[model samples]
Target chain A: MRAYLLARLGWAVPIVIAILIINFLIIHLVPGDPIQALVGDFPTPPGYAEQIRKEYGLDQPLLTQLWLYLVNLAGGNLGFSFANRQPVLPLILDRARFTLLLMLPALTCAAVLGVVLALAAAPRAGSLYDSSVTAISLIGFSVPIFWLGQILIIAFAIKLRWLPAQGMISLRETLTGWAAVADVLWHLVLPGFSVTIYYIAVVARVARASVLDALSQDFVLTAKAKGLSGRYVLWRHVLPNALIPVATVIGYNFGYSLTGAILVETVFAWPGIGNLFIASIGNRDYPVLQGIFLLTAVAVVLANVVTDMLYAVLDPRVRGSYGKNA
Target chain B: MAVQPGNILEIDALSVTYRVRGKTVRAMNAASLTVRDGEAVGLVGESGSGKSTLARVSLGLIPRKIARIESGRILIAGRDATRFSETEWESLRGDPVAMVFQDPLTYLNPVMRVGPQIAESVRRHTPELPLDQRVEELLELVKLPSVVTRAYPHELSGGMRQRALLAVALGCRPRLLIADEPTTALDVTTQAEILALLKDLRRRLGMAMLLISHDLGIVASACERIYVMYAGHTIEWGGAGAVFQTPAHPYTVGLLRAAHAVRNAEGRFATIAGDPPNLAELPPGCPFVPRCSHALAECSRDMPERFDARSGDPHSVRCWLYEKPGLGFDRAGTG
Candidate 1:
């Protein structure tokens, strides 16, 4: 297991470097100048653009610029954002925490809720309750996240007045400690649920199909013939086999949830990396964009590694093969 | 333990129907059979002969929504098992009756270790015993090595896995064991070994066994009495020796012929001429009328009921030719 983990980490280094190179190239390849975007529509002095370009080392050749960026990245310097004029790494770090706070709960909620609903519906497949769950999940899967966020805002925030309308917290409150935490949670409901709806639908459908398949297996019949209660058979024999694929789906979705959070964050005006992503795109802030892309790539790779390890733990067949290879 | 002195399993006129695509198919039709204490009864049939269905029904493992008992009685250990609820069935399953399935790989839970799977049965029947000791005891009873307990189903070979399954079936100290093609998935040498092991275990444990298989040779070797099924009906049944020697029913004759013809050096084999009748659209008369060479006009006109094939012998056959009215058919001269 240790050797396997070390081998995976070894592969991750080159992949991350490849991602860094691609991200740098793509951001530079776009047909607009960051300097021009920064200067805006105001007429400037003749040497002003050249002076700014030289100051940021943008006057160097593309390869030279790439080398400089790589050297700075290796030293843990994410460079400075042209839009905010601050270190890109620290700014992303601040925003990333908020993004994680929003995403972690939503992801967990989706997984738990989806599995429970699927389990309830799977046994009586094609019945009224199962059909109802299927229809609701279909709607959740098909409806756009932005539109769903708006609908939620209109219903709970506008008509029902059950939750706060926007932002991470109430700006007017000077609250701290538990009061502050409660206020933040209160504000999170709409965006968090909206972002989670699609994932919930995806996960629930997968769980239902897999669990149904598992229940039909001969092993389940054997478990039943062994005098196990229906509940015991389901939890012990059915769930572990059914949940293997579900776990992989959940792992892949962890990285995918970030892209989904972008729209929800914009709609709710949440102060997270998704919001920062959009603002940086508009300003042509290459450093911040590269930093965010790099972070996402690293997170996705790590999630896949963790998922593989989980597979080994959950299935003895996989563990046996892994042991042989290691 | 000495063998208990009554029928361990009894099925009387048991008929099972399955609803498939809005049509009800009789999977097992009024199949009556029994296994006495410390006896081995073999059920032999082709793929759709309802042998497995009878085994499942006796164990109360049939899927309720898809299949239903149209009219039947199942008595296990003198208890009326026909009206058993799910909970009642659960209580009866591991203790009074247990089953070993056809395919060991499919029957054993892939994610579980062989040891814990057997231990689960032990826990169900005798929860007071320490689990590790009970598991070891069961494993040893099946002649599996102690280390096999820690191995998963995939880690073991087909023969070893089948042995592990037998260990599980024996864990509950069941009075009756239903082995549904227990050695079918094994190779030739392994099949012989398993058959030997089964006979040895039946003697040691003093449990009645209902062994279901398609192979006449396998059933002949392992069981004292044999029941031959054809298209959801018990066409013939008797002492294994008598049935194999006489084979009064045309279907049983064909099966015996096919079993023997395989040994011909020319690689030629006799086969039953046509397919078994579809359960949903069965003929009004006998199910085997379409495929039987000796089928009479009366055979296609009405179903033949069971009749004694030989005087003073328990051997019975469901053929109109064997019906008593002094037909002068000369049954002993035919086959």
Candidate 2:
């Protein structure tokens, strides 16, 4: 098992490097010039542009710039954000904490809710509860995340006044300790729900289908024939088997959740990596963009590796194959 | 005092039907059989002949929503069990009766260790007993290695998986065991070994068995009485020796001939002409009439009733040919 995990992690090294190169290329190739965006429509004096470009090493050939970037990366430096005027690593990390605070809870809640609803609905595949869950999931999956976030704000924040409309916390409050935490959580309500609702639908549908498939397996009959109760058979034999596929779905969606968070964070003005990502894009903050891209890619790859490990833990057949390969 | 039935299972004229895409399928038209205490019985038939369905019905394993019992009575341990609820059926299963299904690779949970799969029943049936020791003992009873308990189903060979499944059934400490095509997925040598194991276990445990198989030879070697089904009907049944030697129904005769040809290493082994009738749209009378070479005018008009082919013998057949014993004997050229 240890060998198998090491092999997977090893394979991820080249993939992360490839993503770093691609992120750099895509950012450079875009039509907008960081210098022009930085100066912001002001008539640039003749030598000001060249001086700034040379100062940041952008005056060098693309290949040379790429080499320097790679060298700096090896030395554990993400360079300075042109607009933020700070080390990009710390800037990205500071924003990442807030993103994680929102995303971790949203994803965990989505997965838990999805599994619970799937368990309830799969057993009664054609009942009213099943139909209602199906309908709710379909609606949640279909509606655009941005639109949904806005609507949630309008409903809870504008109409009912039940939640704060935007931002990570109330600026007026000088709260500390748990009070500060509570205020942040209160502000988190809208964006978190918007991000989580869509994923809940995604996870629940996948999990429901997986549970149904597990229920149809021959072992379920064997379990039932052993005089095990239906509930016991479901919980023991069905749920673990069903969760294997759902784990894959969750891991595959981790990247998409980052994209979803960008929109939700933007709409709510949450001070997360997603909001930082948008601001960096507008300002063409190359160092921060590269940092965020590299971090996101590495995170996604790690998520998949963790999922594979979970599969080994859940299924003996998978563990055996991994052992053989090792 | 009321007299209790001596049989461990009695399925009397049971008919089970399934609904599929707006059509009702008669999976079991009127099948009947019994397993007396400590006796092994074989139910042999072609695919879709309802042999497996009969086994499921006996165990009350078929889901009520998918299939309904049209008419019949099932008495388990002399108790009227036709009206048994799901809870009653659950309690009855793994105690008075347990089943080993076909394709052990599919039947045994792939993710579960062999030990826990067996202990699932042992723990339920005998909670006070030491589970680990009982699992080991059950494995030993099936002649599997004690170390096999730690392995998953896929790690084991086909024969080993079947043995593991048998151990699981035996863990229930059942009075009766229903093995539905238990050896079908195994190789020929493994098939013989499993049949032998089943026969030995039945003797040692004093447990009655209903061994379902399409292979007549496999059944003949393990069971005392044999029931022959075709198109969801029990056409011929008697002592295994008598039934094999003097199969009364033409369908039974055809099956025996087919089985015999294969056993003799005959290339291009004989198969009965025509396929079994679709239960959704069966012809009037006997379902086998279209395939029966000896089909008579009355055979297509209406279904025949069961008759004793020989006086003072339990051997019986459900065929118009059996309406007159001498006539059926003359046609089959057997006695």
Candidate 3:
């Protein structure tokens, strides 16, 4: 456990550093001036433009700006948004829960549904189930998320009246507790389902392919010969091996899903980091953009770190295989 | 109720065909045999010799993706298994007959602990027991120290895994056990130990077995009767004692000679000529004719029937050499 933890910590160092570098570069090198935005038409006004720039530390050297950003970042002060003057951390925290609440369940649902479909389709590779799933996934992969979201909104929300078309639940409703929680879930259906469809499609395809490969392995045959039920053979023998390939995609997809969640959020006008990110990018809000990007990079790295720890937990060969190889 | 010393499992006209290269390949063709209670019947053959197919078909573990049983009767305890539903097959598994596959490592689920895996099989048979007791009993049955069950497949040695598989197979108190090359993957010492353990288990449980292996010495030492298969055909069948003492079929003789223990290095390998015929493009007559040293024009033109090898019961060869046909010993088309 200690070794695993240490290894994860070691892997995180480079990612954390890369995020710092990329965050600084993206925020620093961008056109237009935050100082100018802060004080409109102050540019070319001698001593006036200089004063606002000095006040915001925009007059500071590139290295100094980076140093300030890094120091404040370590201390949990993500600086203030240039356009809104709101603390970046507060803005992010206010929106983070909503994004997580939406994405977490969507992710879980996608994973479970994908696994079920994949397992069902595994035994019938190239048959109707396989072709149908493959075709569905192809359509899914090709669909523009914004278009898909709009289609869902029209079908489920406007035409059918099965769901609320827009707006997250109010704070007052959520504060009323568990009943409000149920209300949020009911409201969550459209956006969640919209996000999940893509995940389900991709994960299902991956899982089906992996399990098909696993079934052809000698070990799966060995498990069947042990008199294990076909279900047992699938759940115990095939799925575990299948999940190895699945785990790899899960780590990478966490990033893809997190960033991609923005497009859906924008379509539904849902309040998430993605929506916040798009708003930031449109206005060229430097602090908010930097904060969200940094957080996302960190989240992806963290997901990978956790996945690394799960390696030893899932596969003993991975746990000790490298040691033998070394 | 003790098992009477006869007829435990029967395979009648068991034929398994697989599609290969846009053509149907007969993996096993009209293969018939029986393993009597408390007896060991060795299905001996080289790779792709229908031996493994017979084992799988009899167990209902056929690979439905490619392989299909054309027409056959696999009767476990005089009951036709072809008609069993999935649920019925599940209920019958590990209870009436249990199968242990070739590779030991592949037998145990890598993700599962040894004890729990065995306990699962045990619980399948007797699901009412406390899990702890069931686990302990399985560990004892397999003769492993109880602590070994806590270990995963990667943790246990290959031999230990085999023993655990044996325990799982024995869990339901099966009337018959099918072991397909139990010791093939193990080292010499481990192989001997597994062989001995299997022999002991058979004697103690009085469970009949269809021991599927290509190794003649292993069969000669462990099994009582041996059924020799070639290109999906059972070319020779008889008691192991009689077959080894006087191998009837040329393929059987070649296999016996090919075995490392029977033929020492100084004596050059008496390899059978030509490759075993591809079942898809098998010769018009006997499947083994392409490789048989005794093959004649008649052998290629017509299939042979079972005939006496040494004028004894329980010893038969499917070769015209022993029949009152147009050919006699050291002669061409003249008896």
TM-score of each: 0.95, 0.96, 0.91
Better of 2 and 3 by lDDT: 2
Candidate 3 residue-wise lDDT at B134? 73
Model 3's CAPRI class is medium
Off by over 4 Å in 1: A324-326, B1-5, B262-267, B325-335
Model 2 TM-score (2 dp): 0.96
- DockQ, model 2, C-alpha based: 0.81
Model 2 agreement with the true structure over A1-326: per-residue lDDT tens digits? 88878878898899999999998888888888888877778897899988888899999999899999999999989999988989998898898889888888999999999999999999899899999999999999999999999989999999999999999878986889999999999998899899899989999999999999999999988998889998999999999989999999888877555544888899999999889999998898888889988889988889888888888888888778766545
List, for all models, the DockQ compared with the true complex. Answer: 0.79, 0.81, 0.52
Q: What TM-score does model 3 achieve against the real structure?
A: 0.91
lDDT of 1 by residue, A245-281 (tens): 8889899989665555799899999989899999999
- TM-score of A-chain in each prediction? 0.97, 0.97, 0.91
lDDT of each: 0.88, 0.87, 0.78
What would the per-residue lDDT of candidate 1 be over residues B1-335, giving only the tens digit for each residue?
22234988888878899999999898888788989988999999999889999989887889887999999788888888898998889988877888999999999999998888998898888999999998988888889999998899998999999999999889888888999999899999999999999999999999989999999999999999999998888889999988988787888877888877743445667677788789998777789988876778899887666888773458988888887566445433332
User: TM-score order of candidates, best first?
Assistant: 2, 1, 3
lDDT of 2 by residue, B118-197 (tens): 99999999999998998989999999999998888999999999999999999999999999999999998999899899
For all predictions, the C-alpha RMSD in Å is 2.9, 2.2, 3.9
Global lDDT for candidate 3? Answer: 0.78
